[model samples]
Target: MANIPVIAIVDDDEAVRTSLASLVRSIGYEASTYESGIDFLNRQSEDPSCMIVDVQMPVMTGDELQARLVEAGRRFPIIFMTAFPTDAVRQRVLAAGAHCCLSKPTGGDEIIRCLEEAMAGHAAQ
Candidate 1:
């Protein structure tokens, strides 16, 4: 459907990216996945969507990518997904305007909830 929201998932891990794509599509939204932040940026579609990005990556960290996006005047919703979550990192991402920071091993329901909230513009500050 044209009205269905699109979600962009950027992660270096093949398994994570593929799994996320499947899960997102299973929940009714369209999902596009990238192997790296640079790949996503280079071939980003013109869609008003939320981003689910891994915090640590080789080419660019999620925070760095977010910073660049902001500096370039691009304001899309972002939800950071990290396995190595830390207090300082969480605070930094929140301060940088991430919709939310989801610690890895988070359940499917929680991920969907985050996506729904982000699409509705109701994600946590």
Candidate 2:
């Protein structure tokens, strides 16, 4: 059987993590949740097909995680979500190669679209 793609979700908010995980699973991808970027870095055993991350996480923000991954030569596609979306932050992450930065309470359809784009881009690379 082909390996099912895994989606990693990193958020400080437990409720957000739970909901995203359920959504990912409902869409037929495996979901793994991490409370913070540090938790994800410490526990991740394999590269996820894509990452859905929160920008304002306490221990390590989503942008920081992306930097670390880049510094380590990891190329996982990342999608960032934040309650306080800013032009500066969005531009920064996009410049740093993040797939996209989204606002919190984003619709499931938008997330699914971004995931599809990210996965397609990753596969092409």
Candidate 3:
């Protein structure tokens, strides 16, 4: 049997993690939730197909996590969500090769679309 693709959701907010996990599962992907970037790094048993990360996480911010992953040569597609969206932050992540950076309260449909796009791009790589 084929292995299902996993999508990791990393956020300090429990509610955000739960809701995003449900959405990811609903759209036919396995979902993993982590309360922080450090938690994810220490606990992830397998590399996820993609990551949905919050930019302003407490311990390890999304940018820091992205940097660490890149330094380790793990280029899993990343879709960042930030409560405080700014052009600078978005551009920085984009320049660092993030799939996209989304604003909080983002709709389920938009998240799905971004997920599909990110997965498609990763598949083509």
Score each candidate by Cα lDDT: 0.89, 0.94, 0.93
Quote the RMSD, in angstroms, for model 1: 2.3
Every model: Cα RMSD to truth: 2.3, 0.9, 1.0
lDDT string, candidate 3, 43-125, tens digits: 98677999999999887899999998898888789999999999999999999999999999999999999999998999998
Stronger candidate by TM-score (1 vs 3): 3
> What C-alpha lDDT, on a 0 to 100 scale, does residue 27 get in candidate 3?
83
Candidate 1, residues 1-125, lDDT tens digits: the string is 88788899999999999999999999888998988878887898574578899999997999998998888788888999999999999999999999999999799999999888887784344
So what's the TM-score on candidate 1? 0.93
TM-score of 3: 0.96
Alpha-carbon TM-score of each model against the true structure? 0.93, 0.97, 0.96
Off by over 4 Å in 2: none
Query: What value does the lDDT take at residue 120 in candidate 2?
Result: 95
Lowest lDDT 10-residue stretch of candidate 1? 116-125
Model 2: weakest 10-residue lDDT segment is 1-10
